[model samples]
Target: MRNQILGRQGEQVAVEFLQRQGYGICARNFRVPVGEIDIIARKGDVLAFVEVKTRHGNRYGTPAQAVNFHKQKKIIQTAQWFLRQKCLSEDKCFCRFDVVEVYALPEGKWQVHHLPGAFEC
Candidate 1:
């Protein structure tokens, strides 16, 4: 339960960071039958589906490293479902996947890094 709270808090921070960077937030925690998208935003004509990973330290690995090929496939499937449900044509708008890494610091603040167009579907 504590971890869930921290995760949600981290996601909120990611959303705010994206907004500040001129990305229009389209959705948060967008759920489909396949999986959930942490944050969805638009920059110009491109729709960005972002996966946010937060960790206390790099003892295991970097946050972005957690998103492996299998995970990327799941995200892409979910994004497809989202677009279909919204009646949006894939060709009408550009789509890209992004990953946001958040590190929880000792001072109780977070360091956010946004990797735009991080991966391809």
Candidate 2:
């Protein structure tokens, strides 16, 4: 329950951060049988499939570190399905994978970090 709450909060912060950076949010919590993407946004001709990671502290490691190879594979598969669903050809549609690290701070504050092109499909 706590983890889910933190994840939701992180995703919201990531959406706001992307919007401020001139990216138009296209989807949130996009899920399929294969996997799920936290957020999807577009900037110009580029489509970004984002993975959001939130942590209250670095007890384990940086949040981005949690997205391992298996996770990346799942996200890539899901992104491909999303493009096909939208009738977008992979050859023509520019796409990239991104990671948004959200650190929960005291007093309802947060620190956000955006890593564009974090990984490839």
Candidate 3:
């Protein structure tokens, strides 16, 4: 329960950060039969499928480190489905996989890192 709250808080922070960076948010918590995507945003002509990982501290690892190869594959699969559902071709509006790392610090503060074009499908 605590982790979920922390994750939610982190995701909120990520959204604000992305908005400040000029990314137009399209969706949050997009879910399909296979899995879920944390956020879908567009920056210019690029559609970004983002995975948000939030952690309390760096004791475990950087939040982005959690996006392993298997996770990347799942995200790619979901992104493909998203494009198909929207009837948009990746060739027309380029697709990108991004990672948003949120570090939940004490006193309700957070440190965020955005990794655009983190991987290709």
Candidate 4:
């Protein structure tokens, strides 16, 4: 339950960070039969599918390091599904995959890092 709460907070931070960076947020926690996307945003002509990773410490590794090849594949598949569902042509618009890392500090403060065009399909 604590982890869930932390994750929710992290996602909120990610959304706000993206918005401040001039990305128009299209959706949050978008779910479909295939999978779920943490945040969907647009920047100019690019459609961004973002993954938010949150951790209390760096014991494991950096949050962006968690997005392995398998996870990337799943995110790509989910993005494809999302585009089709929205009746948008993949070829007509540019698509990008991004990662947002949120670190919960010891003093109850948080840090966020946004990696735009972080990965590709």
Candidate 5:
């Protein structure tokens, strides 16, 4: 439960960060039997499938570090599922994967880091 709460909070922060940067949000928490994509946004012709990671400190490692190769594979598969659902082919649509790292600071504020085109799908 605690992890879910923190993850949801982190996703909200990520959404705000993207919006502030002028990305229009298309979906949140898009899920399938295989995995879930945290956020989907568009900036002009490029569509983004975002993965959000949040942490209080670097006790384990950086937020991006948590998204291991296995996780990346799952996200990629899910992204493919999403595009197919939208009837959009990879060749026709401009799409990319992004990672948003939300640091939960001691002061309760957050630091959001956006990594555009973090990986290929």
Candidate 6:
């Protein structure tokens, strides 16, 4: 439960950070049978399928490290489905996988690390 809350808060921070970076948010929590995408954003002709990872500290590892091979595969599959559903040609509209790491800090502040093209589809 606590983790979920932290994750939600982190996602929000990621959204704000992405907006600042000029990425227009397209969707949030896009879920399908295969997998789920935390956030989807668009910039120019690029569609970014984002996975958000949040942590209080880096004791285990950086939040982005959590997205391993299996997770990447699932996100890729879901991104494919999303493109088909949206009737967007993958050839014309470029697609990218991004990971946004949000670290909760002291004094009610947070830090965001946006990794664009973090993975390939």
TM, every model: 0.96, 0.97, 0.96, 0.95, 0.95, 0.97
Candidate 5 per-residue C-alpha lDDT over 1-121 given as tens digits, one digit per residue, 9 for 90 to 100 = 9988999999999999999999999999999988999999999989999999999978898898888899999999998999989998889879999999999887679999999988875
lDDT of 6 by residue, 1-121 (tens): 9999999999999999999989999999999999999999999989999999999999999988999999999999999888889988789888999999999999989999889999885
Writing each residue's lDDT as its tens digit, candidate 1 over 60-108 gives 9999999999999999999999899899978999999999999889878
**For model 2, how does the per-residue alpha-carbon lDDT over 1-121 read when each residue is reduced to its tens digit?**
9999989989999999999999999999999999999999999999999999999988999998999999999999999999999999878979999999999999999999999999997
Q: Report model 6's TM-score to 2 decimal places.
A: 0.97
Candidate 4: segments with Cα more than 4 A from true spot: none
User: Which candidate leads the pack in lDDT?
Assistant: 2
- C-alpha lDDT of all candidate models, in order: 0.92, 0.95, 0.90, 0.92, 0.92, 0.94
Q: Supply candidate 2's per-residue lDDT for 89.
A: 81
The local lDDT score (0 to 100) that residue 24 gets in candidate 3 is: 97
Residue pairs clashing, model 4: none
lDDT of 1 at 110: 91
**Each model's Cα RMSD:** 0.9, 0.7, 0.8, 1.0, 0.9, 0.7
Q: After superposition, how far is residue 66 of candidate 2 from its true place, in Å?
A: 0.3
- The ten-residue window of minimal lDDT in model 2 covers 87-96
**Model 2 CA deviation exceeding 4 Å by range:** none
Instruction: Encode model 3's per-residue lDDT on 4-115: one tens digit a residue.
Output: 9988988899999999999999999998877789999998998899999999877888888899999999898888888889999878998899999998778878899899
lDDT at residue 121 of model 2 (Cα atoms): 72
Candidate 6 colliding pairs? none
Q: Give the range where candidate 6 is weakest over 10 consecutive residues by summed lDDT.
A: 81-90
